[model samples]
Target: MPLQVAPTFRDALAAARRPLVGMWVCSGSPLVAEICAGSGLDWLLIDAEHSPNGPESLLAQLQAVHGYPVTPMVRPPVGDPVVIKQYLDLGAQNLLIPMVDTAERAAAMVRAVAYPPHGVRGVGSALARASRWNRVPDYLRTARTTLSLYLQIESAEAVENVEAIVSTPGVDGVFVGPADLAASMGVLGEQDHPEVVAAVEHCLRAAKAAGVKAGLNAFAPALARRYLTAGADFVLVGADVQLLARGSERLAAEFIEEVR
Candidate 1:
């Protein structure tokens, strides 16, 4: 199948009759991006907030993923409109905004992703990679449909306002940040803490009730399966950096053992 011009993450979810598996690409390397694209994964998240990916690096990564089957989604540090616009203009079909704590904040995120009337995303030159560098003049007409917006409910405040946040217009989905959420819940370093688990389940229930997709970041296959069975639509398995670190460590350990 030809690579889609502007495929939304939600579109991918809708297409996923079964559970979907995604991997986080925090390393911003072209080779890594290419590998993930060619892998059988449904989508790849280009993490900018926690990664060392400046715009240049992100451009290269996006280029590397081009022509592959997996869609590219970006998670900006915060849901700043300028940052969101820049990434969207750079060809990110989907956006995952972090630390959404209220319905108003969720609305702001939606506005940043949308055009006028629906939201306040400023429109200008579609002469960017997102529009195939001026290849598509009807970009604005189909932009909304092409873009997906996900709000991260990763804080105590967010869990409290989960219902309102998920009900906001243009909010496509919710992603749980277990680490941050655990900290926010005053149970730091305990992802499986009862309070944290309750918060996550609450968020899931809210998403289901509102008829929106729910997502979770699962670092292990077992955890990924658990989330899927618990009603998560999308599950992020691992990150490029973490995978590399683990592989290198294991290889070095094996070599040392052999030498000994």
Candidate 2:
């Protein structure tokens, strides 16, 4: 018994009575991740998609944040089962899969994260930190409960099928990717476009209808607050690199541009 460690992310989210605010860890630096983890955020998403993070980098980030009170999540490049398996082995229990556009795909993701007889996650617990090297008693039997699967509704097709996708048996939550949804709706680089906002609201409503947690990614404060007001249970507010870029720009503006 590893002291009951901590509540699963799914359990924690379900227990939360208010919306959770999170950020992206795109820098792939363990020290940076630890800083963010301790900065009082409710959660953190370690991105492998659109970021340079690989398994090793992700492993380090997870280890760095392991002692924090925040829930650490992982977003694989895609929802491939093998990649999911690798992340799970590396001890990622909270997963946000990108580009899931259909109920079928969503169900496949559910299966991919589970073990045999119920789903299809290959068993390697004894060789992995996921079970704390089999230290977390009955790891295989209880793995499903400790896991949270959030499928990203990022396309027009996905938005249309949001109801079915959220209704899938093992889907714990649905995440709306505003930028990708905008691009899918032929409005690339305009995540705040009216049509995209409407679509995101629709997905949020669908998640509420299905009784599953709804999440969104919004770097803009207004947009994040808007989605939160519309029933988003969790939101990714910013990225590490984005923060650094903006902060450095501000410094340069003050120190260099001001003197010019």
Candidate 3:
């Protein structure tokens, strides 16, 4: 069978008529990932940053969602080049790098994913699923086009450098993280704080002005809408674990009261 490169998150955004709505698959379970993949959302973020996912589990989840229509993006725990290379070799075409607080860091991430001369991604296509075990023609040369890289602006420093960060070459997009931005602003757990909102908006504007895609992780309907209205090109509006948590709670609330 001929191997085909999938559409990247960048391509999806450029082609999308509206903001691409997505959710987080944080449970580290392939079953949960499969369920979320079929939910008709435009994308799904398979989180390894805050979830219990290891390389094996991440690979399983990625494989599980391969047949679905949703675009699966991965969030590695850190922006280390070694880690990025690992995830890339594991077949994560879309990546959301957390805690990128400066343009230098953003540039480093670019080099981390690119092949040497352009950058320094290690050569191991034959052993990598990303190349379909050497079946993908010109895999090394065309890998960049098939990939999308979004850096997370989760701290005060990142917001302060928002313009430069968005303007960095090879950074496909920036995904503003209000939750951590709130923490960095000393308003821990208050994602909707006015100050955090302002910071988030600052990033949105910078990305849009630079012609780079901007995204947000907003679970609340109102907040997600607000970010979208603020010019977010894509938004993660829900999560698999949260739905189960809230749904099961609601069911228990009704049944426990009647059963006891």
Candidate 4:
């Protein structure tokens, strides 16, 4: 099977007038990644920040998504240079860095994700497992251009600095992490909090002004729609575990009611 490059996701988002649906797969299971990839999702995000997945697990998940229609993305714990470089080297086409609060942080993330001159990402095996062990010789040439870097705007500070953050070079897009943003504003679990909503709107406006894409993490279709209508370029839906739990609970409840 021909290995799909990172451009697929970038192009998909670029071409979409409306928001694209992305499912979060944090289980670190290759099987689950494959399933999600074939499930008509526009993209799959492997959560390394909140999930228990280490480097190896992340790599496996990325590999599993290969050849499928969904583009694979990794959400690293933070925007640390080493962590960013590690996942990029492992072949993650897109990276979602969490808790980006300032333009400086966004710029640092860009530097971490890019190579020399542009940034300080240590290069090793260009033909390593990330490139299918020499299968793609031109990997380095296209790597910088093909890579997608989404900075998570999830705090009051981030919202305030939204304009500067989006304007930073190499920052492909901005994703709103509503839960965290709400919490940071002292309103935990209130996704609909006035402050959170305002912040999201600010991010959208900033992204649009900067001519860059914007994204959001939403669990429900309704929530996703809200973001889309607000001009989000990409929308991430529920996680694999959450989907499974919800489905299982509903099925069990239905069966119990039928028996009664």
- TM-score of model number 3: 0.98
Per-residue lDDT of candidate 1, residues 155-210 (tens digit): 99999999999999889999999999989878888887878877888888899999
TM-score of 1: 0.95
Q: Please, what are the lDDT tens digits per residue for candidate 2 over residues 87-153?
A: 9999898999999989999999999999998998999999998898989888899988878899999
TM-score of each: 0.95, 0.97, 0.98, 0.93
Pairs of residues at least 3 apart in sequence or in different chains that clash in candidate 3? none
All candidates' lDDT scores?
Answer: 0.85, 0.91, 0.93, 0.84
Residue 124 in model 4: lDDT: 65
Local error of candidate 4 at residue 78 (angstroms): 1.8
Runs in model 1 deviating more than 4 A are 1-4
Candidate closer to the true structure by lDDT (higher is better), 3 or 4: 3
Query: How close to the true structure is residue 198 of candidate 2, measured as C-alpha lDDT?
Result: 95
TM-score of 4: 0.93
True-structure Cα RMSD, model 2: 1.1
- Candidate 1 residue pairs that clash: none
Q: 134-243 in candidate 3: lDDT tens per residue? A: 88998989989889999999999999999999999999999999988999999999998999998899899999999999999998889999988889999998899999
Candidate 4 deviant stretches above 4 angstroms = 1-8, 257-260
